[model samples]
Target: MTYRVFSRATVLGTAALLMLGHLPQAHADNAEDLITRGRYIADASDCSACHTVKGGRPFAGGMAFKLPTGSIYSSNITPDPAHGIGGWSEAEFSRAVREGTRQNGASLYPAMPFPSYARMSDSDIHALYAYFMKGVQPVAEAPPASDIPWPLSMRWPMSLWRAAFAPSVPSAQKDVTRPFPDPAIARGAYLVEGPGHCGACHSPRGVALQEKALSGSGGPLFLSGGAPIDGFVPTSLRQDQRTGLASWSEDDIVAFLSTGRNRKGEAFGGMTDAISHGTQHLSQEDLHAMARYLLSLDPGHPTATAWHYDPAAAAALQRGDTTAQGAKLYVDHCAACHRTDGRGYAPAFPPLAGNPVVMSDKPDSLVHVVQSGAALPGMAKAPSAFVMPAYGRMLSTQQIADVVTFIRGAWGNNASPVDAATVAGLEKSAPRPVLQDKPAPLN
Candidate 1:
């Protein structure tokens, strides 16, 4: 064999050519990976909860949000060039997501929760863009224009609101992947503060309708509980024993997020949508991390005592005592499902005793659930869809009020009693449920 003396330059040149030959495949693989990551981010963000309606094409966007001023519909986020975001460049998409700016430099309404999304890392945003632009199927349908009246309907004020209330736009190249000392906590924080946007519904809003706190840095007000939205009030996510998750273990939190129910309670209202479209699909690791971070939070009200189960109400009911204001009504209607002890069948009918949502100082959710009832969304782990029948048609307003008051005060529950006036107000404002030809399956 003849030994060939090759120059180092020649060897390096050949190596470069070989590397270049594989570059296309590498690029393609990277793009696919980014798109995959983006899909996960979208799910974590619960984008579909706002963008898609029941039985509608995913991300086609026709869901209407009824605001105090008027109703505003979500815009199509699919890749259709004409009616969706297909025409948007990555920069345009970034601006819209991070800065609340639209394709035409107009500002997006806060209904999009850009204030929370503004904290998302650039890498995450890039991945989200990749998925929306490449992975998602395009839809040509455009949602109807917002019914918000003029002045409020105008987009200009949105820019001002964003500037004043929203977090500053994150640096384009910055990756805020680790803001906490613990890796798991950091991951959870990112998910909650950025894409998860839990504060949008859970945190109270100021006079300007901006969330009081964006993160834990905003103090106890963060995730402390919010005003009613669509009849149901978002319960506190903090550590308060009475009205928050102080009773929930990390495992319980994980179970609730993944399956929409746990030993403590079952999801209803917007939370059902969140579980069905968003959290149920998340990896166990992510769910655990979220649970861990949530558990780490300090109680919103440090002085609040842990809830203890008292059987006084149960004892009274067992003795056939109908003297209590709403005792007869509860025994007549709710006892079969929720039981006399106020402890319902586990993972089926949620236990009312020591339940955080029930004990919440704000009785909006309790009243709403009593009036409108709620449907549990089915998921992979839990497929049986359970619905609490609406009593609006069956029970008079006073009867409903009395029953709610009894539940709230029963079983050692520390919640304030709701009166007929409060119940009447919620009933009047509550959305009229669409009458179905066939009754929903209770199981």
Candidate 2:
């Protein structure tokens, strides 16, 4: 009887040991999955756009931000024990990301976009922490210090700004129990409002330069239209007939996000960075969801007439009519690439006719493009690069204005005329053309 009892006890002990071994493996797998999710979140948030320096290590943080006040540099976020967030706990990291507060209690500049990140879910925060801690390569590089001036540069004032403009932490946290009217819309909302932070560029700003609309529900200004970034205006995401995406179907948006081009135009300037780093890697489902949410916005305008081809202008141009200086300028300077009809070579030279950039009320983009020229973002799908040569040296201010005016007014694009003064102003402020760099890897 004693021998039999000893054998049973040994078997039970072995089974318990086996279960204990399996538990650790299960936990490790779960942890890996969380890290994977966190990687996705980081991509969606476009953390690399600011954090990573061009031609430098990813997330090692030497990117320069030229604000109206002064230039500031991004911070290193690698898991390096000395330089990165290797020493940070999950709570410290979360506070830094969500509350814009560093572990040492210094306030972060709004350029970090913690205002939008504050809305992220706790689960996502945990997952992000896991990815940063475990999956990322540790880099021991420190970024350059910011160049912001005193009084304004003081971090304490930002705390007061946060108290007034930023949302409370408890309210912003995502609740799984909360039901969205549609799952796609819910996902899109999460992306745009939190990770995507579309409003950071697209939405109009108040006196304090705070985004007037944080989300779609905030007001019509949410993605309706706003200021220009790096010379390219963020066109209205709303459904306006002229300046917005009313003519574009949901598929068009998805296509644009994925490949950086559709019937309208290709991505250039700041948008190129966004597409290259953030949107291109997103799944088709997420792209569609984003399209759906953007389409749902009420732009406070009824759909009017769709822009169509007018043969009259084309015929007149063919006849060599120099009656309109703008028309004369276009035929002389622009027609070869843009074509006589303003319908440019597709997926290469973008068409100006019926294009949102041409139709925008503000001529900043058109003026800047004409002055400084532009290089379309090179993509894997579209391997060949296309460049719009700078006319700043060749063309006079009035001539530049005239050519843009012709494009804007031609082919049923009834945007307001751009004057030489506007062109002059843009020429003074426009960024100098730089040698185009190869597209950076999304990883």
Candidate 3:
């Protein structure tokens, strides 16, 4: 504990930190093994779900993501020395994944979702590097051009956006000493928060498109579900009994993640893709781990339950004032298919009664569905899944909100009604997907 000894310890600590930053780019005991590990990590992170060629090899990179600012496609991240990251050094690859920096010194668009990937540990990062470099086929495909409008499409602005919104590094590990707490559960938490980047899609976004809160810190509002994408409602991960997964058990969660089905509901929305390509492939241990971690979240999280439906809602619906405009539309348009009871036919038409999405606090999914029906994501069980037909073209924002509100309140539900203003905002911002028809399923 002497001064000279203290100085030596401090010097050693600083040197260790410096060495990590200055380490050689992408060193691996076995480059091929490293690449294979990285491929698994990437899948755990669901990278291909967002970044990959439509019909080509898995990581060839051409998936297009639509945002309020513009449409951005996944970049060509293959190890092509000419068109891809063939020349990126180890530090550069880490920077792109961790810091959102491109090899050219430009910041990548937040569309890459590095904000969530930033939570990955150093060892995992190295493993990811190995996978991308060795395991992946070096695709020479050119990246599809983005259609971001003018100033919005500009990539430079994301530099400031990174500083303001992105987390600079990964999150610190939570307590790990607890025994019998399910190693897979901890791994699930790590994968979900860090590599999985589930929050990127499930968490609500701010004006800058940043995740509302990384770890459900603000409230259940964190992943209480987000705006609908490609026509499927984003299921709320909240612990609410009626509107959330109150009825689900630990095993139920596991079954849903692994098989994409549970007594609660079938995975039809974006979840179908998440399950079929993502979690279903994950080891049972990891799935159980994730379910445990999710269940371990602090229930009765600190947030006002402003969305609970009241008697006023019931009175309004009875008087034809509850989501008034929506009521007429439902009776006129939706009721025939969805039924006046709000319960659509069995498996063919998903029932709104006791459905978490229909009973959620947020109206994102409800509104989007009313405005833009579901899109064709390649699947076989139900060929040409019933498209909801875009009501956006025919109904005003208020009407859409009202109908959503009516459906939400129907059938012993307790969710609040949607306002026209909320509907109007999404209609102006959220883009409708243009899937012409279902693509052939992957072999």
lDDT of each: 0.86, 0.82, 0.68
Positional deviation of 76 in candidate 2, in angstroms?
1.0
Number of colliding residue pairs in each model: 0, 0, 7
Over the full model, what C-alpha lDDT does candidate 2 score relative to the true structure? 0.82
lDDT of 2 by residue, 1-443 (tens): 45544588899999999999899989999999999998888888888788887688889998888988888888999999888999999999999999999889899888888878888988989999999999899999988888888866889988988888877667665432245679897888888878898888888888887888777667788887778777778888888877888888998898888878877788877887777778887888998998888888876455556667666667789888757659988888889988888888876777888898898889998888888877765565555666777788788998898888888888888778889988887776797764444533333
Each candidate: RMSD to true structure? 2.8, 2.9, 11.3
TM-score of 1: 0.93
Off by over 4 Å in 1: 1-23, 171-181, 434-443
Off by over 4 Å in 2: 1-8, 23-25, 174-180, 300-309, 434-443
- lDDT for model 3 comes to 0.68
Candidate with the larger TM-score of 1 and 2 = 1
Q: In candidate 1, what are the lDDT values of residues 282-372, reduced to their tens digit? A: 9999999898888878888999998899999999889888799899999988999899999999798899999988888878788787778
TM-score of every prediction relative to native: 0.93, 0.92, 0.71
Per-residue accuracy of model 3 over 1-443 as CA lDDT, tens digit each:
65544588899999998887655543444665677777778768777766665567767778877666667778878788987888999889998997899998899987777877777888889988877887778988887788878877677887898888877773333322224366766676677777777777777788767888765444665566665566445665757666556566888888777655555555655666666567766777887888877776654443523233344534554565534445677778886666555556744456666777777666676677667665433333233234456688788877788788877776667678888887877776554643434443432
Using TM-score as the yardstick, the better of models 1 and 3 is 1
- The count of residue-pair clashes in candidate 2 stands at 0
Which number leads on TM-score? 1
